[model samples]
Target: MDEQTFWELVDRTGPDPANLERLADELSDHAAADIRDFADHLARALHALDTPAHYHAVATSGASFLGVRCAAVAAGNRAYRKVLGAPAALATYTGSPGDQLLPVAERAYRTSTRADWQHQTAVSTHTGSNVAAWGTSWLHPHMGTTTVEGLAPQDYMIALRHVALTLDADPAWRSWWRQSGLTACELGIVAEGRLDHLRPSADIRRCADRLRANFTCASPHGGADLSARAVSEVRSMFEVIRQAMSMPGLPPTPPVPTLPADVPEVPVTAKPLAAMPAELEPQGYLTLTQIQEFFG
Candidate 1:
């Protein structure tokens, strides 16, 4: 079905999975290709909502936010747009269908046409931050007190540069690398040392390569395309690294570790908003103090 028609069906189906049977019945009439297209659109929509900011706005852990993401899509086009405009508005949604919709679509396709239905997109349906945006490094869990002390400063720099350039090619991968503290140079050194020590004969470029390999090997999520499952799985690998780094063996990282000169300094400041959207405010006339309460 077309995008407009798809959303209309979603709205008519409503957010409650209790009525999944009804939704399946409604979708049963569409062509199998249209049903698959509908699945792809739904997958993309879920992927779009899977962002660090949106995760934070939803006020839930990465795992729990899956349901919330589904709810946003199930709410239909207008509500989805509102959530995009004011991410915090997603906080208002609760108990949204998580992974239920796709299966329902699949079941509908299968039962009606007596044929298999499969998701055919690289877009991820899973919701959650692939990695935490800031704070304690995800690598801290895996490489405990691990530091490569013997590598020459120049050699370490070379490795760091290589890792940076390799991951920097992709914006999302680069963000994941930086946020997990891999860009610290020392972590990259540790990762390389750990990998090389683990497999002496392997031609390992750096730890990032190994991580990327792991992500790739876990690919073709749901046997369709590279789905979000890879990211969710890779996140576990990252968490282990982050934990390992936090153990009490190596000295703490330099308070002022040298950063690459090419890296731009991001100034910390809030961009002032002209006004809060009217929809965000509670219904009824708001007083001056209440207005300050909302803005402040």
Candidate 2:
């Protein structure tokens, strides 16, 4: 499925989150994989050179014939379930119409009945900028010898699609994902959890920080450039987030090297690593500056 079809699928549903569970079926001929690949196209297209990138971009990014907010929620939820635990805690938080999600922690309480979910209570702000700025891990569950540097855009799409399909398989997760405001908050959860105990790559955190810092939607030149950058980085970061999260449907990614308990922090001025640990040396994680820089 291409970008146009993806939006067309979403446009038929309008903005109601309630209609999402059945949304994938709307693309009748498409498989779960197609729905996910469509999400990749939609994400890239929404933040295209012509489109604007805003927090609300998912809701209002496209023109009248196509608004992508609901589609983004579907794609994001599909990706979300593959995260570290896909937390049972997250499942408890059913979204609603008038959710007070600002302080994040407050929203967590209102969304979930469980008390143990406090770890994720802060939502996106759960990890302050300083923490992510310090260091991040580029690791995956069940080491398939995966590293963020070696990933392709399709690889990210596959992982996210896996999550979407996984959630689709479970009626409960899909039900909550279809609720109002859950998709947005869930994306926020994915973003905030980047630095959680899952051991995200410091490179991802740095990139995310830079993306937020450089974002300026008001200025013409600034917004255009920022939109372009957001497009690239969001794709890259989702893959990074996938690496940080769990992979469900794909093959096992090879493990990189054993990382130290305290992963070293990358300096802003420093280039990607020139070398990698012996285990990763044979892979481009050693030879390629792009792969080695972030995960080494």
Candidate 3:
């Protein structure tokens, strides 16, 4: 369907909860099962929203279940898009031709306290265009010391939008790598490290070789082309190393010196240990009383 038609349906119909439930009920047993599975997977995804590790896990799994080619989750504001290496156009929700549904999804994410609201879409086979599908789910903030209020709702919305877009583009293998906490640059560095470590394992070595090649081809400026699944795996591996390196008791780094090369050095001198008049001293040491008496 065209974006205009899809949006017109949304505007006219709004979100009919009862109608959605009925649609779910009308699905064939297998399709219904898949939908249920998708919902469950989404819940898990919400739970992992805040954690880098969990974010990678949920993003990867959600893409796989939904059959998307690539997916990403981001936190913070628009600055994160640059960090993730997304195209400048993709970073903002401009309500453009390809992104009409984004504003709706962003609103849902902002207001919904729970992580139950979700939106889906499909890619047109003929046009290679993304068409909006329906989605319902809540937003789940990452767990830890901070609460949901601590996070930027826009960031969550962007992540959701990415997942939906990937599902539309490639439902066969969900793409979750885009939502990972690690930026593309960070992923590349981690991948480089892994290649070095797994040199002994032929299978791993081969995989690493492919990853290295892909990394080179993508170029830091170009976009990542690997499946979302591969991105997730590489990101997960990177996280493991990051955590290990962050552990306590690691040797501290030495401080860098800041002294100037042109500064002059000062000289040092030592003074005599004892004080005695040379005139009072004879070939041998003179007793103090004898010397004093002679002087007197």
Candidate 4:
């Protein structure tokens, strides 16, 4: 089945094991590879969202090292689309950004012109300057004292350059980045160090990578095309991971709400009083003030 159809079936079926098993069997032996691929994709995602190795990486490599090199992937996507006036993005961001920022960013990444996970790139260009710094700032408040020990000044510089290069496109973002922390000189040195490939003593990346691979929990998300059963099984595994880590489980996908049969269609008053003819259309909409003239 098509991805949308598969998702719709999943939504309507509510992940009943029977439903999943039936779906799985329907695929037949020919589809076993698809099942395994889909399952692995989910298993990997479970590993990334929580798990001990994820934190190990967080402690050494920083949040960016966990996924595709940035925790703000979700936020960047939303902020970029919100800035661009994307129809779907605007609809979702109607309320205050508040805690919903991450989901917004995720959706933005899924829907924006750069729908392929180039979130920081979009956020960098859209907001202008240091997308990394901006993204890192968002992570800072939540990171607590878990600093990446021995984070090589060189790797750090490379990360900073990723952000600093946006300067030519957006000086304002850089101005904002500098305000996040460190004096201008400090930021300058970081930039210079990045240019010079300097290091304080050692680095954190290798350690983090080692721990990341060493952890048996799972791995980062992989492969896009997934069967519904694979999604279900993956999410189920995610539950296991969540329980193990004492992290909150993934929220259950709610079935889309439908209009009740008893509910009337839109009332006449909601529409215009009359449809203007072709010639009369040029007169324009008759506002309340203009319509009042008739009564007078």
Top TM-score model: 1
In order, how many clashes per candidate? Answer: 21, 17, 23, 3
Query: Quick one: ranking by lDDT, best first?
Result: 1, 2, 4, 3
Q: Report the lDDT tens digits of candidate 2 across residue range 17-135.
A: 56553453354345544544554554343222111111112212122112222123233333323321232322222232211112222223323333332232111221112223212
Whole-model lDDT values for every prediction: 0.47, 0.29, 0.25, 0.26
lDDT of 3: 0.25
Tens digits of per-residue lDDT for model 4 on 46-150? Answer: 232322122222222212222211121223333422433332232232222222212322333233333343323112111212333343321111000001222
> What local lDDT does model 4 show for residue 278?
75
Ranked by TM-score, the better of candidates 1 and 4 is 1
What's the lDDT of the predicted structure labeled candidate 2? 0.29
| Model 4 lDDT on a 0 to 1 scale | 0.26
Stretches off by above 4 angstroms in model 3 are 21-296
Q: Which stretches of candidate 4 lie over 4 Å from their true place?
A: 9-31, 36-154, 165-296
Q: Is candidate 1 or candidate 2 better by TM-score?
A: 1
lDDT tens readout by residue for model 1, 106-196 = 8878977997655566465443223333222223111111123222123233323322222233335445455444443222222223322
Task: Sort the predicted structures by TM-score, highest score first.
Answer: 1, 2, 4, 3
For candidate 1, the clash count comes to 21
